[model samples]
Target: MYKIITDGSCDLSTERAQELDVLVVPFYVSTDGINHQKEIVELGIRDFYQFMIDNPKVFPKTSMPSIQDYLDVFGPLAKDGIDIICICITTKFSGSYNSAMNAKNMLTDEFPDVKIEVIDATVNTVLQGMLVEEAVAYKQMGATFEETVAYINKIKISGRIFFTIGGMDYLVHGGRVGKLSGIAAGALGIKPLILLKEGEIFNNGLTRGRKKSKQKIVEQIINIS
Candidate 1:
């Protein structure tokens, strides 16, 4: 049987991953000098978000999975002769794709017969989740490997994502926003509409409030569709 693999950045919960027969390799999140594996974390999504809010002084830094982490998952699958389709976070956002590719190269000599395809998702969170779901569906429906790859590539270009941040502090800490802009937005209750373009994140525009920001995102999607 073939296997679908993705990293923690895909926004799929562990339970959902299991249900879809997808293997989720974890990424690391560091807060207060403690590294937490996102996949095995005890906190749920809501709690994690809350934790971020409660601990404003501690800005969490996320890191891509290591080469060894990819090897640990791919090695056994290769040994078992299971073909793999690994969809990783965008190269612009993280190094997970590179690590997965390196792992594939390392194992190629040992498992010459194993087929491993690593794809750069060029997106993250729910967007990548959607792509992974489509890939799993196509694989289950017996689409050829080349056909599946082609479908993902087509969808990747067509996909558009728009979102508004809850707090500008996170963006400022991550260097996505200037400190002055973040401070001004926070004081004025302004939320910026952000989007992913060509694997990089960008701020599209600003809304006065969170509700308006969300509405603007919906309208943008409707207009584009």
Candidate 2:
């Protein structure tokens, strides 16, 4: 049987991961950027956002999983000879793809018979989760490992992730605010809507306030559709 896995960037909950029959390697999150906790697994969403709001001095930091993290999951499954398809967030946004690849390489010589493929999802958040679910469905339908990988690659071609930052602290700290790179993100009422297409982040346009942020994302989706 083909096994599907993804990183925390997929925005999937623990229950959702269980229901989908997919393994999720959670990203490390921290308020101090030193003491880290696994996303959802150790850190809850409500607490994370609350910390962000309560402590404006420091934004919550997100760290991707390491090669060993992937290996821990891969080693057990590969030993059993189950084929694996690891779907990771876009390489541009995160190093999850590289980490997964490194883990696969380490085991290549050891488990020559076990098939292990790492996919660059070219997307993030719910879109990334969607890719994992698609793979699970394909497996449930009896698709082979090769066919599932092909479907993932084919479907991600048209995937586009549109979003609006309710808060820009994350982007500012990430040092990839694009056109607004050097500007003060919190200054004024400038709410920026962004897009993720083809593994790159883009500053689509500016909205007015917090309420308009979600509306802007929806508008972009409607326009695209």
Candidate 3:
């Protein structure tokens, strides 16, 4: 049998993950630099958002899962001779793909008969989750793993998502934007419409307010459609 694994950035609910028989590895996020919590395991999405709402001055930073994290999940499955397909968030946001690969290598020496394919989704959030869902669907349909991999890779290149942040300070903290640009945008109450292209993030343009930013996102989607 084939096993499907994904990281928490996919944003799949625990219920949905259980329903699909998929395993989710979590990333670490810290509100206070010293203490880290697993993204979905220790901190629920709403709770994380609430923390942001409650503490505007704090900038949350994320760290990718470690090699041990992957081994904790992958080892048991490999021992049972299950082929694994691990989907990770884009390398642009985290190095989870690399960690998974590292784990696969160590597992290989012990379980050389089993196969493991670690994938980079080239996206994050629900967009990344969509690819995971697609992989599950392919597995259910009895498609070869190679076919599923090829399809997701093609979609990754073509997929696009437009998003905007409530504050520019988050972008500056993440080193996604220059501090001066973030300050200038913050001063004018402007939000930058961001999107991923070729596995990299780009600020498409700027909008004056949150409402306008949402409108721009819709317009961009409609234009593309």
Candidate 4:
């Protein structure tokens, strides 16, 4: 049998993970001003989103998991004769992909016969989760590991995610936007359309107000959908 591994960046819900029997390796999110660190999954999405809202000054920074964390998950599953295929966030976006690869190499050395394949999702959030769901479906249909992997890569290319953020303050603090742009938007009360491309944040444009911002987001989603 094959077991699946993925990271918190996929934004897969807890219920979905449980139902799919997917193992989630968490990534750490930290704030510069506060020592309190949280995993993306440990803090529920609603709570995490609210935290981001309330503590706009924190400037969230994300970190990849330690290799030991991966070994702990992969080593035992390998020992138990279950092959592992880990789907990770894009290397372009996070070091978590590299971390998963390193863990795969280490697991190969320790459990030479146990198969470990690390897939680059190339996209994150619910899209990645959808890819995982497809993989799970393939497995259930008795597709080989190689076939399941191929399906995931194809899905990665076609998937898309788009949204808008009301606050540019966080993006500016995270160095994603220039101070001048953020300040000007604050002065003018403009909201920016945010698009997720290649698993990272990209600015679409500024909107005059929240209603326009939301309408723009809806249009973007309709176009993409």
Instruction: Show the colliding residue pairs in model 1.
Output: none
lDDT of each: 0.85, 0.87, 0.89, 0.81
Off by over 4 Å in 4: 31-42
lDDT of 4 by residue, 71-169 (tens): 878888989988889998877778888887888898788788788889988788777888888888889999988888788876688767777777777
Write the number of the candidate with greater TM-score, choosing between 2 and 3.
3
Q: What number of clashing residue pairs does each candidate have, in the order they appear?
A: 0, 0, 0, 0
Predicted candidate 1 versus true structure: per-residue lDDT over 31-58, tens digit per residue:
6567574644554555666778888888
Displacement of the residue 48 alpha carbon in candidate 4, Å: 2.7
Q: What CA root-mean-square deviation does each model show from the true structure?
A: 1.7, 2.5, 1.5, 2.2
The local distance difference test score of model 4 is 0.81
What tens-digit string does per-residue lDDT give for candidate 2 at 58-173?
87778899999999999999999998999999998889899999999999999999999999999998899888888889889889999999999999989998887766766676
Highest lDDT: which candidate? Answer: 3
Task: Provide the lowest-lDDT 10-residue window in model 2.
Answer: 177-186
Error of 4 at 61 (Å): 3.1
Q: Estimate TM-scores for all models.
A: 0.93, 0.89, 0.94, 0.88
Clashing residue pairs found in predicted model 3: none
Candidate 2 residues lying further than 4 Å off, grouped into runs, are 177-187, 211-213
TM-score, cand. 3 vs. native = 0.94
Model 1 Cα RMSD, 1 decimal: 1.7
